[model samples]
Target: MVKWIVKFRNERSHLWAKVVMAIHSGGRSFTTIPIKNSISGVWKNIVQLGKGSSLKLSDVQNRLEVKMGCGDKIFFWLDKWVGDYSLKDRFPDLFAVQTDKFCLVQQRYSLTNGEIVWSWGGESPATHTDMAETWAECVKLLEGVKIEKKSDMWLWKQEDKQEVFKVSDLRSELDGMDLIPET
Candidate 1:
C-alpha cells in the first residue's frame, strides 16, 4: 500500500501528492528531509506498524531495483540503479571525490544515434589513490548501459524482470529474511 501510494505520488492527482508528501515526509515538510519521529495523524499508525513489524521500510528500499529509461527520476548516487548497489555505495572512494554526486544517469550518460557516451560530470578524481583502478571498473560496468527515452520504474528485485510488483511476493520475500537473531 505504501509503495502503491508512493508510485503515484508525483504523477497522479494533486491531493495524492500532498498526502504522499505528508506521509513520506513523516509530517515534517521540506525543512527536515531526513529526520523521523514526527508523523501526522494519517501516517502515525502506518509508521508505528512499520516500527513494530519485522520488515522495515529501509529493507524494502534496499531490495528495490530501478529500471532506468530516461533516468531523470532516479538519483545518480543515492538510488540503486546498478545490479545490487548504488554507485556511491559500490564506489565510495571515488564517490568521495566526485564533482557532482547529484547528477542523474540521464545527465551523466546519453545515447546519440546508437552511440552511448558517458560524461561523468566532466571531472576526474585525481586525488584518490585508487582512482585509476576504480574508475576503470566503473567505466566498464557503465559501458553496457544505455539511456532510452521511456518512463523509469522501481522494480521489486525478488520478482522476475517482466513481473509486476505484488504485495504477497514482497511479503513472502521479506518473511524469508532472518528478522530474529539466533543465540
Candidate 2:
C-alpha cells in the first residue's frame, strides 16, 4: 500500500513499462477476462503511442491530479526495499542489533517525469560491521540538497542533475520521506 512516484531513466524504459503495465493490470492478481482485456487494451494504446508519445515524469503530477480526481490517496509501486533509518537512529538501543536482513527498504522512487529511478547502491544491505559507512554512502546519494524553502514548502535538488525534482506539501510523517532506502 506504500505509494511511490516512479521514474525510470532512458536505459530502464523496459522496466518502467512493465511496472506501469503491472499497475494498470492490477499487478499479479488480475485474472478476470474483462480486466485482462481492459489491461490489454490499455497496453495496446500505449504501445501504439510509442515511447516518444508516452508520458514523461514531468507529467505525473498532472496525470495524478486527473486520475485521482479529489481523492487524497496517491498510488505508486515499490520495486526495491526500504528501511526505517530514522527509527534506527532514534532508537539505536531498540534497533541496533536488528540485522540488515530484517530491515525492509523501499527500492524505487517516482520522479516528476513519470519515470522510476532505481537506487544506486549495493544489492545487499550493509552488514553490522560496515553499517556506518554503508549508511553514510547511501544517505549521501539519496539526500536532496536543499535549494529553497518557504513557510509551507521547500525545494530540494536531487543528485541526478539531468532530472530536476522538487517536493511540495512537505510531510515528513509520511513514509518514504523522498528518499530511497539503501539495501
Please list the C-alpha lDDT of all candidates, in the order they appear: 0.59, 0.31
lDDT of 2 by residue, 1-183 (tens): 002332221112267545654555443332111123344555445333323433333333222221111111111111111132233343343233443312212322324474334332335455545665555554554443221121111112233222223333223323434345568
TM-score of 2: 0.23
Q: List model 1 lDDT by residue over 1-183, tens digit each.
A: 345423542242357544554455432122111224554554455545555667665655655566777776566765667767778778887776666665557777667688887654536645455677777788788877767688676666554453446678767766787878799
By TM-score, who's the top model here?
1
Question: lDDT for model 1, on a 0 to 1 scale?
Answer: 0.59
Best candidate, lDDT: 1
lDDT of candidate 2 at residue 30, scale 0 to 100:
21
Task: Candidate 2: list runs displaced more than 4 Å.
Answer: 1-39, 51-127, 130-132, 147-183
